[model samples]
Target: MPGGIEGFDRNVFINCPFDKGYEPILQAILFCLIYLGFSPRIATEANDSSTVRIDKIRTLIESSLYSIHDLSRCQAGKKGEHYRLNMPFELGFDYGCKQFFTDQRCDKKFLILEEKAYRYQAALSDIAGCDIKQHAADYQKAVRAVRNWLVSEADIVADGAAKILGAYADFQEWYYERQLAAGFSEDDIKDYPTSELLAAMKAWVALGKPI
Candidate 1:
């Protein structure tokens, strides 16, 4: 089935137990439950608050990544069933997020970047009636808070953290492009810190810059 909510309906038809005669009734109930279980809320409380929206989006992206990592571990297990479930679960998460935005691509090496871009776009759209400069400043401040935490406790950040850090740098670059496209002047976004920038970007995307 395709990853979007609509595709889920078609998928159930394909999994139909109706042809089996007696089991169709039971299967129908089961499918209904399954559908409800997997569906994400169409509108969240954060939708009204840009900051909350940005936080939720970043949480989704990180959750997706963590899910992927867990699936990888499952695939590496000696048990065959564990490995079998890994592929389907991983693919489902990938498709769900990919289908969330029309402009974002969802392949490896690009999923994180795509998520960031969609988030930024979402943030800007939500806060359009508000003060954009103040929003941007609040966003930057939140980012610096996260950066300060990471920098002060660098040793515990773990290995290969560079790769994660590099992804943020890429996100910043994409954010710059997005802001430019939105007609935000050069002076607006120039002073934001890059290293601790992911939190800021996430704030912008999820929470919609502070009040």
Candidate 2:
């Protein structure tokens, strides 16, 4: 099987925009995943141009028992700008993998997120009936959406969403101070590699942040 890796059940494949504009929501989602004791995996975790990018993504999909796909960037942001399709394309691939792979793969779960409810229908009409959680461009809302979904789908017993959001807020302040103390400028911290950011989050959670 393609998903023979250890800890596959706790792996979560996150598919979202990597732009600066989406950082806050992305970070919130990441924090929620880690706080709930799930490992979040993304395409940026590795840089192997020698291997086909789609193959890497397919491997990630096969290895993750759950996935969260944010299609908020499906529409163009500015005049004449091209719409982004990568998010939905990967979502389709993940769904296909679960459907056509072994029986264990069919147990895979997914959560689809958007900036506004029903907005995705305008562009991706094929997924019209699927439940799409709306974050409305609010990072806290995104955290809550992820928290509630995990609780319901993964059978996780988590603190209230407000409490988790509060912990994230505290972590943000601490992360900034610590990063600055380490001689990283604001831009440097903001643009830090995603792997490093994930490690920092894991370290912070290891300190027993009341999540």
Candidate 3:
């Protein structure tokens, strides 16, 4: 949506929580998508407090041919915490878009991710018939799930998860050095934004995904 439909066929809408706890898996997903030559679209790519958030997200979903929905953080972790609905909410919108907009989005595909086995069945029983993949809070498993999904649904020939993980580690080191050389402090690196990190991953892949 940000760049129009130029890369719509290779664009992937990422629906997940934006929090410190989910950062690792989030990075893994971003790196995997960029490494495999796909564009990863997430709400954080822009920081416009003035813009209506759901409208921005719907624009992204409509522009993407594929999506990855993570329902891992839907359940509240503590007794007083309210469960999250944004992830599942966007996922439903994407599904409905594909089903209702037959002419424009009939071919859209999505992958559902959970952190635990059969967890969605208890809270989101309507999706019981859909196949969901669990990551168990492991970045490597997340990479594998994303890689396999892209391969199967998008017909992409890609590197295996382990190899991609190794390359991801290499990119982190490369990016850290580059940022420091450009005068970014260690603290700055630690606070790197996901939107910026996605750009760095694309640059790393462009440079041949050096290891």
TM-score on alpha carbons, each prediction: 0.21, 0.94, 0.95
Point out the higher-scoring one by lDDT: 2 or 3: 3
Q: Can you tell me which runs of candidate 2 are displaced by over 4 Å?
A: 1-3
Better of 2 and 3 by TM-score: 3
Which lDDT tens digits does candidate 2 get at residues 12-73? Answer: 99999989889989988888899889999899877667988888898888899899999999
Pairwise lDDT winner, candidates 1 and 2: 2
Error of 1 at 171 (Å): 0.8
Residue 121 Cα positional deviation in candidate 2, in Å, after optimal superposition: 1.2
Candidate 1 lDDT, tens digit per residue, 1-211?
Answer: 2233243321111111112221222222222222222211111212355466434443444232111111112222254443334223433444565556443223211111111213223423432342111112222322332233223322223223333344445555666787789787887665433222333444433543222
Best by TM-score: 3
Output the lDDT of residue 124, model 1.
Answer: 30
Weakest ten-residue segment in model 1 by summed lDDT: 9-18
Clashes of each: 12, 0, 0
